[model samples]
Target: MRRLKWVSIVAVGLLISLSGCKIVKNPDPDSAGQADANLTDEARMAALARDIWDTDVLPTVAEHLVPIDDLRVSLAQNEQAAGQSHGLRPEGEANPWNFAVSGSGSIVEANTTSRAAKLQVDTTGDGAADVTVQLGPVIRGTAIRDAMPFLIFTDFRDQIEFAKLAGGLNAMAHERLSLPEGDIIGRTVSFEGVFTYRDLASAPEVVPTALSFEAPE
Candidate 1:
């Protein structure tokens, strides 16, 4: 009777321990506590830009940002001026508003399967950009990452489908982008309008840095 009781107790304990294996293996050992480490200066700045793009940019400009009727034109009454152009500075007038975006890219968070990226917008015309917008930080399996889910809105027809607009937006949110702020969080900004650019580096000047600001249709 003693042997049988001891065997039964051991079997129960083993089963309990085995049941926890799933829980123990759920965490990625390489990723444990890594989220808190101080990213290198380059890494931190890059991350800030990315956060702006993911958290700020994509949602704002996607089809739903502005009313279906609003996005019809390039500019809007509420939109802010981009400043003067670089070349024909009108003699004394401050140089043309030359803004550009460069080094745009993305980063994927392994654990949550979320993605973050940087959207560079320069208005000064100089190679380096003045303002930056981070957008996304989009979670995996969300409407943005996968299929489009219908949401009630004023003009769903004009609104760019969430998935369809992701490619161009992602192209804008490249990995190597930069921003003036070392730490970018809790900033109210906006980006709209369709500006053309040749490549990430040589794009147009002083283009708005949307900073994840939604599109104003």
Candidate 2:
């Protein structure tokens, strides 16, 4: 009788332990749902630029596009306010205007070393350019990425990932949007792009998000 009672108690304990193991192996519905949500967030971040460009940028461009010449004037008039109102602040630092601009021009010169091609655009479409547009070969700075209202530092897992995302966007622009050295010379081009401003006299070196060109016939 004593032996039988001991055997029964051991069997019950073993069954309980096995059941606990199964529960751990197969998560509950709520846990599974949370995991799925996390994955979705990560996927959303992976396509951050495309997602924001469609949802946020296009609409903003339609509504708020400042002509390149007009923007330069504004920056000259009130550098601080222009930057604060139009530009996105860097993750932790404060700076002057980082803004978007749109214009059309002919490529006056191409500088491969600086990776910046110069465009002669007449904001008024007169005989002369109101401002010179600098197109990038190496698009640096955080102006464009930070300018998007939808993005926040916390949206990324860490600063490293955020930097990678920014660099990836730059690479995408270079690959898909930038014109070849031979193709850009003497060509007419139109662009919408972002720049960071430190002073009025400095030229706006733009990293174009949208660009279209017409080759000389």
Candidate 3:
């Protein structure tokens, strides 16, 4: 935990310093090639959001969620290339193929019962909140299995509770949750992250808009 805190501070300093430079963050991957006149640091942040979503978040999700029949998933744009590698030849060669890249990682869950639905989002890979996650709670019953559902964000402290969950290993795996307030306190959630080379390649699509900025209260 101490190490994570230091990392967050270093990242913040770097971001602040970069804000003064000429380069700005780009929002869309497609827009990356185009040259802009002069964009502010805020614009750069938006651009950063876009690139992060496409390159990091989106692909990660797609690789995990997208399904493949064989133990090995092959990613290809056409069947002829896929057929050359794998025994099976896809009927429609135009469509892309999915091949196994690596074994799956741990699963993490994110969920909320808070009505506000806001969370402290911390990016920059520091493993700490640049701002804070004020999202609602996904409460579990006081007892184990059998319990009544309740609102998670009924109080302000729920923010701290929510952060504990979001900052967990699940968020590292790029998984978020939507759950009843009662269940957030105790319950295991599933999550995964993946990286693939193609656009249609089954992987998580980065939502730059969601991850673009530090959540400020």
| Number of the top TM-score candidate | 2
Clashing pairs in 2: 83-97, 115-137
Instruction: Provide TM-scores for the models.
Output: 0.21, 0.66, 0.21
lDDT of 2 at 181: 49
TM-score of model 2 (CA atoms) = 0.66
Q: Which stretches of candidate 3 lie over 4 Å from their true place?
A: 1-38, 51-56, 60-179, 193-217
Candidate closer to the true structure by lDDT (higher is better), 1 or 3: 1
Clash count, candidate 1:
49
Rank candidates, lDDT, best first. 2, 1, 3
* All candidates: CA RMSD (Å): 18.4, 5.4, 25.0
- Give the Å shift of residue 101 in candidate 1: 12
- Which candidate would rank higher by TM-score, 1 or 2? 2
Ranking by TM-score: 2, 3, 1
Which lDDT tens digits does candidate 3 get at residues 78-140? 534443553221234453332312222211222243543333222323443222222323221
- The whole-model C-alpha lDDT of candidate 3 against the native structure comes to 0.32
Once fitted onto the true fold, the runs of candidate 2 whose alpha carbons sit more than 4 angstroms away are: 1-13, 19-22, 26-46, 84-93, 111-138, 178-183
Better of 1 and 2 by lDDT: 2
- Candidate 2: tens digits of C-alpha lDDT, residues 1-217: 9999999999999998998784546566578566556554434444665656656755655455677777766777787766655655555556445677888776655555566545655445455554455455456766666666666779677987677666655544554555554645566778887777767655667767678888668
Instruction: Give the per-residue Cα lDDT of candidate 1 at 71.
Output: 23
In TM-score terms, candidate 3 sits at 0.21
